[model samples]
Target: MLTVILYHVIFVIVVYTDTGPPYNAFPQKLNFYYFSLYVIPSTTCFFIVLLSTIFLVVKVRRNQRWRKGTSTQTAKTNDKEDKLVRTIIAISTIFIICSFPTVSIFITQIIHKQFRYRDPYLGTLLLLMFNIGGVFQAISSSVNIFFYYRMSSRFKKVFASLFACRRSGIQGTKPSD
Candidate 1:
């Protein structure tokens, strides 16, 4: 899926960030460990979360696709459930959009020197923006479950049943494949 590809994209950017005549830390031995471990994993998580949100939203939207003569707009407007899904998608989209520039900026700066133009001030600023955006985005991810519950009845039912099992002290059995 695109989620996996996004991870690779960020990875490529990370590699690129170290290329050419640029900021040297990324290309240095000391930074190698942190770059390969923490930075890569965190960047992958960000892209995975983003792409998953997009996939869910697209699935919801696809369900409301217009038939030959039916009105897509009408369905969204008239149906409360679709409207709720639309809202969830909208909120998720906004969060993803707001964070993308920051994420990309940091990735670009890390992998490419052109973004910072070798200026320490610009480097500090990009890093600051990326860190701040990531913190806020983490909060947004945490709230996604509530939105899913409100927007998708299937999700709500599964969540309820899972909690119900815990309340009853019953270990839920997995279904046979």
Candidate 2:
């Protein structure tokens, strides 16, 4: 899959780069490592997801246009399709927003060569940006659970049933006989 290839390519680049000295031993080397492991992956993933999302949106819209004004059933189907596309777009947009700070900070560092020599302020700023990105990334990933529960009645039912089963198991109960 594309994800597999992307990971492989980044791994190779990280391994092949002459990063000099072990990780965290030198501030400069640590900065390079951080950017490689965090920034590059986040940026690449954002673009990959963004492009695919755009392509999928276009395809879904085109299909909608082709099938417009067909039948009541088709209209229902279109509505569901639109909701699914919207959900996907929401998720991808969140990803890009979450990743922007990370990518921008690292790219700025690279452009300015800020990491070539130790600078405590830059280090603090990088850490702050990294933490912010991490928080947003976590939110972006977990928000889909709520979206599924809200957007799809079936998902809501299934999700509720799943938790109900867990609760029953924990209570060691078989509903009143």
Best by lDDT: 2
Q: Which ten residues in a row have the lowest lDDT in candidate 1?
A: 25-34
Write model 2 residue lDDT over 1-177, tens digit each, in one string. 797578767765765565544645566555656666666776777788879999999998987886774534455787899889988887778777877776777678768876433567676776777789778878878887887787787989999999999998989965786
Q: For residues 104-158, could you state the per-residue lDDT of candidate 1 as single tens digits? A: 7658757875555346667677667767777777867677777778777788899
Runs in model 1 with CA error above 4 Å? 1-81, 84-88, 103-114, 170-177
Q: Quote the RMSD, in angstroms, for model 2.
A: 4.7
TM-scores for the candidates: 0.50, 0.74
Model 2: residue 146 alpha-carbon error in angstroms? 0.6
Worst 10 residues of 2 by lDDT: 15-24
- The models' CA-based lDDT, in order, is 0.65, 0.74
User: Where in model 2 is the C-alpha error above 4 Å?
Assistant: 1-35, 69-73, 115-117, 171-177
